[model samples]
Target: MAVLIGLAAALAGPGGTAHAAVPDSPAVTYTNPVAEQRADPHIFKHTDGYYYFTATVPEYDRIVLRRATTIQGLSTAPETTIWTKHAAGVMGAHIWAPEIHFIDGKWYVYFAAGSTSDVWAIRMYVLEGTGANPLTATWTEKGQIRTTWESFSLDATTFVVNGVRYLAWAQRNPSEDNNTSVFIAKLANPWTISGTPAELSRPTLSWETVGYKVNEGPALIQHGGKVFLTYSASATDANYCLGMLTASATADLTNPASWTKSQSPVFRSSAATSQYGPGHNSFTTSEDGRSDILVYHDRGYKDITGDPLNDPNRRTRVQKVYWKADGTPDFGIPVADGVTPKRFSSYNFADRFVRHWEYRARIEANVSPLADSQFRVVTGLAGGGTVSLESANLPGYYLRHKNFEVWLEKNDGTTAFASDASFHQRAGLADAAGVSYESVNYPGRYLRHYDYLLYVQTPGTATDRADATFHAQ
Candidate 1:
C-alpha cells in the first residue's frame, strides 16, 4: 500500500505575513484514506536532522528502518535492515515493530517476539547500543525486559511526566472482562515494573470494540498543560480507529480515573476515504517548529475478503495535525492523496531568497478619513496572493488580493518611490518602474523584505512610519 503523491510545504516571506502560500494547494479538503502495507508504524526525529520510520513487516523476521532528511522524504527514502531474527526462540521469532529510543546514556530498541512453540507468546525485548554513534555503531542484545507477570503483553511505550517515569502497554487480562485490555505502571528500570498496574479502560466504545473488542498500540503526547494517551482500537481491518485519553498536567497521573476518554475516536476511516484500518499512530514535530505531523498506517480497500492476517496493503502515511482553539491537539480530518493544500510561504531571508518586509501603512489619505500609520502595503511578494490590514486597537481584519493595488488604491491612489523621497507619484498599475504592488508567490520562492520578516503594526506617534525595507544580514 503506497501513498498517492500529494506534496506540500510551509514557507514564510521576508515580509512577515502569518503564512506563506505553496503552489497547487487545494483550498478545500476531501477525505480519501490510504491502503495499509505497513503495521504499527513508529516515527522518530534523529539528532542529525532526519526522521527514521519503522513498522511491522510480518513476512520478514527482521527490523527494517527508513530515514530521510524530511518527513516527506521518509515516505520515499531508502530503507535499511538494521537487525534480523536469527533463531527460533526467545529473541529470534515474530519480531514486530521495533522502536529505537535514546535514553540516559544509551540507545534501547524495544520489540515483541517469541519462540517457535507459539507466536501468541509475544513478550517485550530490548537491545542496547554501545558505541558513540548508533547509525555507525553496534547494538548488543540486552535480552528480554521483565514486564508485568502476564504471559501476554506488547506495544509498550516508556514516557516521563512531571519528573516521574512510567510505562504503558496493552495486554491480555484474564481477571478483566474480555482478557485483552490497556494498562499502565511505573517502571522499576527500563525493563522492570515498579508498582501495580492500573486498568485504564476496557474496549467498550463502538470504535474500540469494532471487531473482537481489542485495544492496543498506546502512544503518549504532551501539550497545552495536558498529557494525551492515544491508542489503537479494533481489529487490524477497516474497523480500526484511534481512541484518546487526556489529563491535565496538574492531575495525579497514576490514577486511571484522572484521565478522561474521548466520546468518539480521534481518527477513523470515513466513506469518502476508500482506505481502512487506520490506526497505530505516532506524533512528531517539524524542523521549523511550526507543524505537528500524524504518522500512521492505512489499508487501501474496505473488505478483507480472504484472511486479514495475510493482507499486504498496509503502508505508512503521514499528514500535518492541526490544533483547536483551546490549544488541544486536533487531528484535522484526513484528505485523499493529490488534494492541494493551502499555499504556504517559505520566506527564510537568511538563505537570501528575496528581500521582504511588512509594517503598518502610514496613510496621509485625504480621499477618506483614516488614522495615521493605519494602513500597510506588505511588499516583496512575487506573484498572485493576498494582503491584509486591520485596526491594531480594534478587533477587525481586512483582506484583499495582491494582484491589484488594493493597499495603494485604498490609500488615496498614490505610489511613492521607495528609493527616493523626492517624488510622490500616483498609482495606476503595480508593474510600473516606480509603481510597486504585491503579487502571489510561486511555490519555490517566498516573500522577503527587511532584516526580519514583516507584519502590520498599530498606529503610533504622529512621526511613526508604516514602511519597511530589506537588508541583508
Candidate 2:
C-alpha cells in the first residue's frame, strides 16, 4: 500500500473535479449491511465515478473496502481489503474505520485501532497505497499517527483550505479524562501532524451530551464558503447524535474560538422512522454538484437491549442533505412510514414527477367503512374509467386522506406520469393498527392500500417510487 500512497493523496482535488450529471437532488441509495458486521463507516467518492466505503469490522480480521458506481451498491458490492493487520506494536491489529482518501497525488487510508496486545491503545494511523486502483495498490503500514490527542485518538479527517492542509478528529486531551473531544490541527502530510492540536468543539451542546461524555468522528466539509465541521456525539447507542460547528472560510480554522457550535443536532435517531443512532456521517456531492447527501447507520429500535453487540439494527442509511433558510442544515423529521415529500420533485419541475410500477396494493374496508368515502387520486394520476393503468393485488381498502398523494405504477414495464387528487377525507394515518394494506415493508414510507403517491402535498422523496418500493439489480 505504501507504494501507491500517492494515488490516495490525489483526493486533495475532490475526486477529479469533473462531477457526474447528477440531478438537482442526489439520490440516496442504501445497503442494509453496508459491509455487514461493520461499524463506524467512513466513505469517500473517488474520481472514478464510484464511492469507496470502509468500516470497522471486528469480525472481518482485515481492513475491508468496497466500491460501487451507485450509492446503494456499496452495501452489496464485493469488497477487497487493501491492507490487513500485521505484527505487534506499530501496525499490528484491531483495525477500525479504514477510510481511503486521495491527496497530493497519493492514496492514504486513515483508521483507528489498538496493538495486538493493547486494545485500549486505539489511535489514528494511515496506510500508504501506491496505485491508481486502490485494490491493486501495495499498502504499507505507516507509523503511529499524531493527532489532537496526546494519548488516544480516532476518526481522523483531513481537508485543505487556502493551500494549507488541516486534520480534524476526536481525541482525549491530556488534561481531560478519556472522554473524546473534537479537535483540529495542521497536517504535514497524510500521516504527520505538523502543528499542535487546537480545541475546535466539544460535546457541550444538549444533543452532544446525550450519552456518555461523548464527541468524536469529525468529517470536515467546506460548502458555500462555510466551513462545516460535522461530528458524532454520544455512545453508539440511542444517545448518539450528529452535531455541527460552522464558520467562514476566512476564519482561523485551527482556532476553536472561530467556530460556533449549533445547540440543536443536525441529525439524530428517529424511533418512529426506525432509524436510530444516526451519526458518523460523511458528505457526498452528486455528479451534477447540486445534490448533497449525508450517509450514516442506525438501528430499528431505540433502546440498547440485552446485548449491545448482538443488536440486529444499526443498518446503513442514506438521505438527502437539505439547507435551511438560515444557511444551516434543515434535516426535518425522518420520513415516517407511508408519508412522502412532494415539494422538491413535483413542484420543482412541471412535468417531471415520481412514479411506481409492478407493486402490490391491497386493503380491506367495512360497511361502516374506515372513512365515509373511498380512496381516490389526489393530483397527477387520474383514472377516467376502467383504469388504463394496470394495477394488481388491490382489495377492499379505502385509501383516503385529508392531505395525501399517490405514485401509481402501471403493469407495463414503464412507469406512469405523476398524478395527484384529493381523496375522501377520513380517519387514515391516525390509526397505527393500520388495515391489512398490501404495501412494501419500508421503515419510513409504505404503499398504503392501493395508495399511489401523487404530486401535491407530498412531503419528501420518501413518497417517491424509489423510496416506497425497490428495483431489481
Candidate 3:
C-alpha cells in the first residue's frame, strides 16, 4: 500500500514543513533482493516481535536462520547456521527449503535433505528448539518424517486452523506421472503427520509442465474466511511460477474434494521487471502489521548457464500485497528493480492504473509492459516539501504537466521542469486513506484522469473528486 500521510490544513512554501495529521517522517522504502543467493525463502513473524527468516542456501550444506525487527532489515541481518549437514549418510547433502515456525511455545524447523551417497534421496526432516530465541536455542534432530509412500519430498510447511494443526508439502508419488504434487494431512505433532495424506494438487496444466511436471513449495495463508494455498510449478528455471488452491476455512481440509485449484498461475516471472522464475513464496505482514508482504526468490536476469539450480543467483525479494474488493489478492506484476515501485490505481476505476504509453500519461487496465504503470514517489526535483513520480521502467523520466496534460518526460535539469514535475501530495479528495497530487506550479489544479487521459484540473463533482484520487501500491 501507499505510504501516505494524512492531510492537514496548514500549507507551507518550499523548504518548509509539510502539513500532515502526524509529524513528518521519511517513507519506509526498500530495494529488491532482500537476501542474496537465498532461494525458497520463508519468513515467520513471532509473538515476541521479530521476523524469523530462513531459506535454501546455494551450497546445500547447512540450515541457517536470521531475525530482524522489520522485513527490510532481513537483508542485512546476520544469519546463524543453526544446523550443519552430516558428513555422510542421511541429511548429508541436497539440503533445501528450511521453514522456521513457533509452535506450542517452542520453535520447529521443517526442511528437506538427501544423503551424500544418494543426493536426490530427498525426504522431510524436523528440528526442535525449546528456547525463546531460535538462534541461541539448542536444537535436536527429529530424523525423517514418515509420510504416506514418500518417494521424493521436500518443502514442508505447517499451519493451524481452528485447534487442529495441519502439515502441507510437495512429494513425488510413485503412482503419479508428475514429478511432484502437493499434499496436506492433519499433524499429530510438529514432526508427525496423522491419517492418510490427501493430494491437494498435481501438475496437469500446461504451465505446470514446463521443463518438468512439478508442483512444489506449498505455502498457506488464510484471509476473508478462506484458506489460500500457493505452490510452485514447473522446473527451477524462468518457467517456474505459482499456482494456488482455495478452500473454505470450515471445510474438511484433508478431504481433497474441499479444495479448488486456480486454472492459471497466481504469480510468475515478469520480463518487464527483470524478475525471472518467481515462485516459492511465503507471506508475512509489514512491521506495523498493516500490510501483507510476499517473500520469494528470483534471478534478476533471465538467461542462466547450465542448470538453473546451479546458477546460484536466485535472490530473495519482497513486495507489498494488495487485495481486491472481493477480498482476494492481486499479486500484480513483479515490481521493477529499485525502490520497490508502486502502481497507482484510480479510485473510481479500480481496474485502471495510472500508466505511460509512448510517453503519454493515462489510466489503463491490464497495461502492456506493466512496468510502465509503476512509479517511485521520490523527493521533489524542486527540493521543496513536495514529491515527484518517477517512471519505474524509465529511471530518469518523470510525470510532468504541460498545457494541463500529463506526460512522462526526462529530467532536463531546469527549474521549469522541476516546477512542472513536482506535486504537493494531499489526502485523497474522495478518501482520506488514498492520495491526491496537486500540481506544484498550478495551484488549485490536481492530477485527475478523464476520458482515460491524465490531466491537471480542478475537480468540481463527486465523480471528478473520485477520479482525482488514486491508490499508490
Candidate 4:
C-alpha cells in the first residue's frame, strides 16, 4: 500500500514546464497533527466522497463528528457534538474512543463510557445514528454491550470478511489480574455478540508489558487476503504503542488459534521525531482511493507534568501504509514530522530499493530501519525546473552525478552539486507503468543499475530501459 508514481515518457520540469516534470502522480504532501487534542482517532471514508472523523476529545465528556472532502480539510472542519455522556447512570462519565461506522444503511458509533458514581466502572456502549448526514442525524443510546466478564472493557471495533461480521475489543478477564487483552467474537447484530469470545492477544512482550501489562484499542484492516488487527498496549504514556495480530482472510476469525500476535510492536514512539505513544490507530484510504493511510494520535513531547491522561496534547496524524513483499504491512518507524517522502524500488527487482551504500547509489532489499531507503523528492538544482532526491536520514546530502555516476553527496550550495544533482523525471521507456530518471545535463543518459551500482547510461534497448526504470514508492 505504498504510494507510487508510475513512469512516464513526457519530460516535464518542477515549475510546471516540459524540461522535466514531477512524477505524473505526485506525492500528496501533508503535515502531522491534522487535528489537535484528538486521541484514539478513527477516520472512515464513505462512498459519498467524504471522510468522516471522530475521536476522544481532551475533556473526555462527549463524542464529536467532522467530515471533509479531503483529509487535510478535517484540520479546520467544524466538529459537531454528536452525543454527550448521560447526566447519570452507565454512560454518565468519562466517554472515550468513539468510532463511527456505517453498516447496513444505518450508522452506529461504538464507544466507551464510565459511570458518574464510579469513573473506574468503564464499559462499552453504542449510539445509533439515523439519516443521511451523521452531523445532522439523531443518535440514540443503545445501552451497554454485554461481554464475557467485562471487568474493564473499551475500544470496540468491527470488521467483515467473506460476508461474516466480527467484533473485536479490549477487555480484562475476571481471572486475569493484569491489564486488558484483545478478544474477538461473531456479531449477530451491531450491538450484540452472538458467540463466545476468544482471546487473540495479551501483553507479553517487554514493550507491551512496560508500565502496565495492557492491550487495548483494537483496530482492524483487511488487505492482501489477510486480516490485521492492531491494538495499543502498556500505559497511555510514552510506553503506549501499537501491536498487531495477523490471520488469513479465509480463516475462522472467531477462533483465537487462527490469529498470530506479533512478537514486537508494529508502530511505537519515535523520540527523534518527537512523536510519543503512537497507538490507537484507524485505517482509511487516500484521496485518490488508491493507497491505505494510518490515522493515529501521538504526543508531541515526552515530558508531562501530571498524569499522562491529563496532558491533552495528543494530536491526530496520518501517513501512508506500506506492505512487505510477503503481503504483511511494514509500519516502519513513526515517521518524523513534515511532508513524508517516498522510497524508490527498481522495476526489474521488486524486492530491491534504491539506497545508499557508503554514500554511493545502489539497490538493496527493503528491510527494517527503513530510513536509509527513504528520500525527499524536491525541486531540482539551480531552479532548473527538474527534481532532486534528498536523503531522508542525511538532510543535506542528495543524489548527484559524479563522473557519470550517482552518489549521495553533501549539498555544499555549489553550482556543480546543484547541476549534478538535478534529474529529469520521465516515463519509463521500456515499462510504460514505471518511472525513469534521466540526467538533466546529459539529456539522453538515464540512471541505471549495473552489478548493483547505479550509473548514468543511455538506454539502447528494452533491457537497458527496464534496468533504468524505477517505481517511486
Local error of candidate 4 at 326, Å?
A: 1.7
Q: What is the C-alpha lDDT of each candidate?
A: 0.55, 0.56, 0.86, 0.83
Worst 10 residues of 4 by lDDT: 12-21
Q: Which candidate is the best by lDDT?
A: 3
Q: How does candidate 2 score on lDDT? A: 0.56
Error of 2 at 60 (Å): 6.6
After TM-score superposition, the amount by which residue 58's alpha carbon in candidate 1 deviates from its true location, in angstroms, is: 3.6
Off by over 4 Å in 3: 1-29, 343-374, 379-386, 391-398, 407-419, 424-435, 440-444, 449-453, 458-473
RMSD from true fold, candidate 4: 6.0
RMSD of each: 13.8, 14.8, 6.4, 6.0
Q: Write the per-residue lDDT of candidate 3 for residues 237-316, one digit (tens) a residue.
A: 99999999999899999998999999998888877668889999999987877677888898888888899879888889
> In model 2, which regions exceed 4 Å deviation?
1-35, 306-313, 333-473
Per-residue lDDT tens digits of candidate 2, residues 1-473?
A: 00111223332223222111213443332334444456667678888788878876745247888888777678678888777776677456567666778887778888887777776687888888888877788878777786544477888878888778888888887776447888888888778988788987766666666556778888877666887888888778877878889998888888878899888787776654466777777777644556676666666677787755456455555555655435566554443322122211211111222233222222111111111111222222233221122211121122222233443333222222312221222222322211111121112333332232332232233223222221110
TM-score of 3: 0.84
lDDT score for candidate 4 against the true structure: 0.83
* Error in Å for residue 391 of model 2: 22
Ranking by TM-score: 4, 3, 2, 1
The most accurate candidate by TM-score is: 4
